[model samples]
Target: MEAALSRLEARVLVYVMEHVPAAVGGRAVEIALDPDGPPAVFASAPLAPSPGAAVVFTLGRSGRRVVATLTDADPVIVGALLARVERAAPAGDPVRILPLAEPALVDAGRAGVALLPPSAGRWFPDLPDAIRFDAALVQVSMAVFLSPQELADAQAHGPAALLGAFGRGERDLIRFGARPR
Candidate 1:
């Protein structure tokens, strides 16, 4: 029998597919995150300009679907990283960097994530509540892998500050194991 998606699952899939560029050849891939963990489907697509870089976002609604844009597009490496996020998602702030025990894909092991609010010319969060999804559209967070020192900097100053450093340096935020400095 064919499996059907729940309402929330459908919404999460639509949201990610709509926001992620189609030019990257993004497509959903189903994978078992763990033997006992919940099932997950993640969208994977290559990022242009940066060779080997790719973006992957979950289609699951557990603790809100997560998006990871990394330098290594390998599913194994990305799955390992996502597994870490899945384990940590329910514990604290939904948007922040979490430390990874080992190097993820690239040289960096630290990972940072932030919610991506809806925007159309203007940020939807600034609009009236009725203008948006009643309970907020399927929430999604962008995850970026970072160096240990970079994670420390984000924890010290703030995620925004670390992101600013990337912007100022013209660094590719999706680059896995990237150290903005």
Candidate 2:
């Protein structure tokens, strides 16, 4: 049944919609993962204030799903990042680093991707709703692409330290590839 198939994804989608009003009833674009594989449906919406700020997230993947807030919503780049997630994410591991060095990311100057647990009250505006989602035990992560040097820094100092650097600059988390200020 379609309901059964969407059980987990549906809940997460609901949480996204509730927090991201701009994404409510927004267009859902499906990017094919393979010639015969199920596509990843990205729920996308443009944020206000910043003309180019937008958020795109997957709603079809089971267990771990990826979300990113970027300067712009480029499907091609997002798709590439999602493909890397599919290939690199290890089972039972909450954190993942996906190596990516391509022309698409040249503008951002990021050579790798870090998938980290979304900070409470950062991605989800409603703490109560986020708490409820936590009860479900489904994991939704923020995808922040890092430069080679930054990736090495993370390796040396650890992901927590990297997150601390990002946290120091609140907006850095919302803007992918942004170096901590």
Candidate 3:
């Protein structure tokens, strides 16, 4: 079965497909909806090696959260990018490790939590649209917004605003101590 992803999540997938800093072993924009462990970071060269660090993110009714993380990571890249984020944390803030229950979860073209696999089409959370956005997008949206038509508009608009959000989100990953390359 395919993963169940929200419309915005789908758009973000496409956005990552387009804007990943680099692609080595494929543009790794690995995302976990509700992850665990040290945040991971993934991007391409000059910024990092191909597939920097897989990114883990999540959305919830209370709020949104994101972190860049890695299973095994590069020291130089980790030092350069994650240092800033780590500094922001209180000493001993544990790295949240997303449980990828299945290795297949991040396999080439997957999305969502470890328990669920990737699926086709837009996905709505198990909630009403009134306050339906996941935590990450909720934070990104910064305000209440959207409808089916608006979602289509956002999707069809070619990820521009989302890209801007992605940029900011990447910075957030750095802040969250996403381990590097």
User: Which candidate has the highest lDDT of all?
Assistant: 2
Pairwise TM-score winner, candidates 1 and 3: 1
Alpha-carbon lDDT, every model: 0.51, 0.57, 0.28
lDDT of 2 by residue, 52-123 (tens): 556666653634544544445464466456544644563345566667766677567777777765662255
Question: Model 2 TM-score?
Answer: 0.72
**Global lDDT of model 1:** 0.51
Alpha-carbon RMSD, each predicted model = 5.6, 4.7, 16.9
Q: Which stretches of candidate 1 lie over 4 Å from their true place?
A: 1-4, 48-52, 90-94, 102-136, 166-169, 177-181
Give candidate 3 misplaced runs (Cα > 4 Å).
Answer: 22-48, 51-62, 70-181
Residue ranges of candidate 2 with Cα displaced over 4 Å: 1-7, 21-25, 60-62, 73-76, 120-136, 174-181
Top-down TM-score ranking: 2, 1, 3
103-129: candidate 1 lDDT, tens digit per residue: 544344444543322221121222221
**Estimated TM-score for each candidate:** 0.66, 0.72, 0.25
Better of 2 and 3 by TM-score: 2
- Specify the highest-TM-score model's number: 2
TM-score of 1: 0.66
Q: What's the residue-level lDDT of 145 in candidate 1?
A: 61
Model 1 residue 15 distance off true place after TM-score fit, in angstroms: 2.5
